[model samples]
Target: MPEQPQWSERTLDMPPQDPWADQPTAPGTVPTPPPPADPAPFSRGRAQVNPQPHHTQRYAEHEPTGIGWPGAEAPGAPHGMTWRWSELRRGSEWTTAAVLFAFVCWGIWALSGGGPLGTPLIVFAVTLAVAVGVFCLARVVGYVVLERQFGRRRRTARGSHLVTALFLAGVGVADLQQTQWVMDAYHWVAGQIS
Candidate 1:
């Protein structure tokens, strides 16, 4: 018969008990509470609800202006004007740029072996360029004429949240259009080169 396994002498090792097990301790292990805060000083008179006014003006009053700077609010009436010329210009610029980029993309797409839209693409691009350009020119004329008529401080302000939102939206659309335009152009060019 085979030799009997050494089960009689072997034993399994068990894990050690946790130090924090629920056992009674012989030493002190309690925590202490922190000191309390001092009481506020009391005034004897009747309290007035009206608080002192602060000197700081609105943060928007001090924003800067420019072309590449994105959104800059245009100057208007002395108090608070609804439309700022600068903001309009910025919006127009964003629109124009997006349209132009799209047009160029279309042109590129046409040049490639794309389809029957080559001539149409070119026409569309030209029309977009002219329309946007005219709109920009009209804005310039309108601003100059209005400024000449209305007298006061012509200071330009930085863009507001609304203007920024408009710009970002336009840019987002342009970016999406770019993907399609670029892909089509690439295929067209590739087909031609090969």
Candidate 2:
């Protein structure tokens, strides 16, 4: 290895001279070094720990590494690959197929052909449609407001949302059969438009 250069022989910038260099110091006084830059940001002065951990004794010894321990992503997502209309086309197709099947079931009931099985099939299809629609809408719009406001950490746990959606869907289907709320809402919207 090449020999290191002496400080006198090296090219170096001059250190700033102390303004108080001319002042006489108190006998045996030691000058203090500058305080370190903050470790974690946005913090006030720290409290003393009674028993500091051995590992943390050399707190600033290691260089920072921002990586986390690797593992499988937590199961269901908003994890990788944002779902767009193109990605959701397959789901749209399935929904369309389900709706058609429900229509066919309704027609069979209307014609008075398939009596016992007809109503059950229509109910089942509508339920499936509601469940699938809830999930699709969630996937599409869940992140829009959430990601803007709170990032990934602030996402509301989806289990409650799913449960609430399912309950509403059940109520909607019941209202569809008994109350004709869709017709009422359509007329209400038309009145508002007019």
Model 2 per-residue lDDT tens digits across residues 50-161: 9955774643343334443335333222454355444445335444544555455444334443347666667666766676667656664655545433445233335324
User: Which window of ten consecutive residues has the lowest lDDT sum in model 2?
Assistant: 68-77
Checking candidate 1 for backbone clashes, the offending pairs are 71-159
Q: After the best TM-score superposition of candidate 1, give how far the Cα of residue 89 lies from its true spot, in angstroms.
A: 7.2
Best by lDDT: 2
Candidate 2 colliding pairs: none
Task: Estimate the TM-score for candidate 2.
Answer: 0.28
RMSD of 2: 18.3
lDDT values of the candidates?
0.51, 0.52
TM-score for each candidate, following the candidate numbering: 0.25, 0.28
lDDT of 1 at 67: 31
Q: What would the per-residue lDDT of candidate 1 be over residues 136-191, giving only the tens digit for each residue? A: 45544444555545623334322222233344345444544446656677689999
